[model samples]
Target: MKRKNILLGAFALLLVLGFGSCQKSDLPLDGTVSKERIAALQSNLKKALHDTTQGWVMMVQGLNANVRTAMPVLLKFDTLTGDVTTRTLFSKDKQSSKFVLSASTGVPLLSFSTFSYISQTYTAANTAITDFFFKVLDVTADSITIQPFRKGNIYQSEGGAIMKLFRASSDKMKWALDLLNAPGNTGNIFTQTSLFGRDLEVRLKASFATDSIRSRTGFYSWGGSLNVVKSNTPITRTYPTLNPIVIEFYTTFPIPANAVPLDVNTVVGDGLIYWQPTTALTPADYFLNGPNATINFLKTDYLLIKSMTANSVEVYAVDASGNVCITGRIGD
Candidate 1:
């Protein structure tokens, strides 16, 4: 009789514990309805990504820079056959590899299932384009948006890495590349314009190293063309009575417009390139050309790219903390 009573007591305790485990909050648990809706959404996105018949253009935040520095890449996905083709702004090689679409963590996650250049973008010691295990945010007939899915990832807020993929045409990809490399587009000068479109004289913020912003009338210049040369005296300056100083800056190296020419000394030493006041900022020949140009600058936290215009583009420089240190608008 006692054994029976003890058994009944144990069963009652188990029931109470099970009931207490489900402490409800504001979450809706209509159960089947919610689960079905999620499943349907996942199914729709899967179909869109897998059916990349015409290829897709993906716009993601520059791995080492900000959204303003975003670029597009071409992608072709085939989960059924388990392979993907991808291209980036820096490399033209069409990397192919096995990929997977899964719900292993309760949400749709897409990742390269093998070792390939596509995965290298994320795993590479230099670039941080972590789209490997992309968490699907939204999907439509022609486009899908995604963000990196690092478990306990803390860098998302500091660096905006959200990406969007759209159905792409061949012409669009060509245009993106052309805009980045248009002749004289990057090396052109940028200055603040007044209300009447007059060039405003930029005054540099006073510093312990220098006094008076007028120390240099031309605050910015683009390098990188062997064709047109930097003047013997690129900048003519005016200084205050406390510190009257005259300085001339010039360069002969093939410094690209979208880059700062750095001598070997600079690269191995401080590795910081201040865009405004220097001669031959960084040597262009020292590095490879094309999309790699941007990657090289990213190593030092300096991003110079042609603006998205036929006659104009902007140059932006950032500090180690990912904040904009200086900006100039170059125009023809």
Candidate 2:
């Protein structure tokens, strides 16, 4: 009788253990639901960036310390790959780069592996800042709202520096390009003057000057044709296409009164040199070289329009590293 009782007890314990094992295996506690959600969000993000008829624009503030509230950036995402192209006042040309889409701690985030035009400026300005990853907070048909991932950066700890991406059309894209390209008072090629007459005053803020001149200094202008002036020496370059505008000193002509000669020789001028618009080159490349290439103003990669009028314009130059190398006013 005792042996039979022991056998029954052993069988009952085995059955209980089997049931417990089965229950654990069948429990709904796996991360399947969260994983599905993350996948769905990633798909949605890819579609949002690439499926639309046009690109997207985001007004990013807090990226630069010197500027105002924000700067606008345009981005186009590739439909077939993780490639991205960006247009900004940071450069005269468009930038092509790639980004990464990653899932972290049950959230989807986007980051740039290569330095896009926008990232170049942002990271260059803030040395301690590294990540450009934006946490996907929300998305809509026309907009995506994102905040920087909490990675011990300014946007994460200080908070409220959220970036908003909005849909942009083809026409909007063209307009943005045009705005960044325009460099003269007229802001177009057709409006360049025959001679940058005495009316052609320059407010130079070149890299070497003691202080940026507020008052417009008188200068002369002639089209591509060479014209000798009595006292004022205007930078002689092809107007409406000031591509090869020369900043060399003219022994025959003196610089405007109280005006410092705008030369690469005087400053650490290895960047963008200022020039007005021209017909042959709507957006032209300019070089500021000193005697025998001793000084090279090769750092200027950007021309930004600050303000404009019928006869007057305000502009500045920024290098690839987000340094505003020069700012000046032009006009009557």
Q: Indicate which candidate wins on TM-score.
A: 2
- Give the TM-score of each candidate: 0.44, 0.47
Q: Which tens-of-lDDT digit does each residue in 1-332 have in candidate 2? A: 99999999999999999887774456458888888888888888888988876578775443323322234567888858778887654344566888888987576888766856545433322222234677776678877887655434455453235666877664434444445455534343123344233444555576645655443332333244323211111122111122233433321123456544432111111122332112222112212222112122222223355655667656665432234557776566
- Model 1 whole-model lDDT (C-alpha atoms): 0.44
Ten contiguous residues with the weakest lDDT in model 2:
229-238
The models' CA-based lDDT, in order, is: 0.44, 0.49
Where is model 2 more than 4 Å wrong at Cα?
A: 1-28, 63-69, 125-130, 150-160, 170-303, 306-312, 315-332
